[model samples]
Target: MNYQLSLTVAICFGLLVLLGYFLPDFDLLILLRAEILRWAAILSGVAMFVGIISLLKVHFNKFMDQKSNWGYSLVLVLTFLITFGAGVFSFIFPQAEGLVDFMFRYVQVPVESTLAALLAVLLLVAGMRMVRYRRDWTTWLFLAISLIMLIGLVTIEAPIPDVFPFLRDWLLTVPVVAGARGILIGLALGAIITGLRIFTGADQPYGE
Candidate 1:
């Protein structure tokens, strides 16, 4: 009974959203869509809060169980608490916004950038190993493109005029852009089909 009610609501809301998007000139639908989106935003915030509580519970359990790598779980909990406390403090006292900004700019950004740099190095190493072992045209082509992009970066920054910058721009503008558009179109079609399936009761991700 509950599953049927939920499925009915899902189909109704999904169709309403699709109608709102495709029929922008309908005044009533536009208003309904706005209200639905506002409710969605509130629900999304509540979901995030629930997710945080779930995360904390899992980590706390791990820390208490003395399992392998439990020390890392403890560290995670401590970091989460500190960050949450800082955010609360900023909310209560507006003067602490600078501290929050500093933490985001220095701590968060650097950590993210460091991870990205490590990933790039790992990919480069993997590409080199693949080319060495595979001896395939595809592998060689991939490696060659990677090398060209790297060289383009270096040349663009150098103190000499070169065609690398133009070549990089052309590659990005033509092949990259075209490929990205194709991927996006495919994804949009897939999402539409999935939504249609759910709406028609052909797919019930929640339950039977």
Candidate 2:
């Protein structure tokens, strides 16, 4: 009974949202849809806050238990609290704007850039290993594509009418776009199927 009620509510809201999008001339439907969306956003924010609390509780428990590598959890909690406090202070104080900018520019950006550089180096190493050990046509093709893309990106400042730029543009516009669109279509179809399963009670994600 409870499951049926939940499924009915989900299906009704889903259909209403779809109808609102397709038949925009209905003022009442549009107004109701807007109200539903507003509530959805509020609920999403609440869910996020709940998730953060749950995460902090789990980590705090681990720290209290003195589990192996619990120091990392302690550090995570400290950093999370510090960042949150900093954000709140910055919001409340006009003078703290500089502190926010300094944290983002000096601390966050450099950390992110370092991680990205490390990832690029790891990818290159993996590609080299694949070429050296596998020696298969597919491995060679993957390595070739990676090298071409890297070269194209690095040589972007080369004079116009250059081969690297031309190849880069072609690869980006054709193969990359086609692959991305195919992945997006697959994801959309999967979501639709999952939604249908829930609507029909074929998949009872909520519980038995």
Q: What would the TM-scores of all predictions be?
A: 0.81, 0.76
Q: Flag regions of model 1 displaced more than 4 Å.
A: 132-135, 151-178
TM-score of 2: 0.76
**Model 1 residue 132 lDDT score:** 78
Across 1-208, the per-residue lDDT of candidate 1 in tens digits comes to 9889989999888888889999999999999999999999999999999999999999999999998999999998998988888999999999888877888899999999999889978987887788779997888777777767777778335663467667777888999899999999999999989878999988889974
lDDT of candidate 2 over 36-130, digit per residue (tens)? 99999999999999999999999999999999999999997998888888888989997886776788899889999999889978987887787
Candidate 2 regions off by >4 Å? 87-106, 129-135, 151-170
C-alpha RMSD between model 1 and the true structure: 3.1
lDDT of each: 0.87, 0.85
- Cα RMSD of all models vs. native, in order, equals 3.1, 3.7
Q: Could you tell me the lDDT of residue 64 within candidate 1?
A: 99
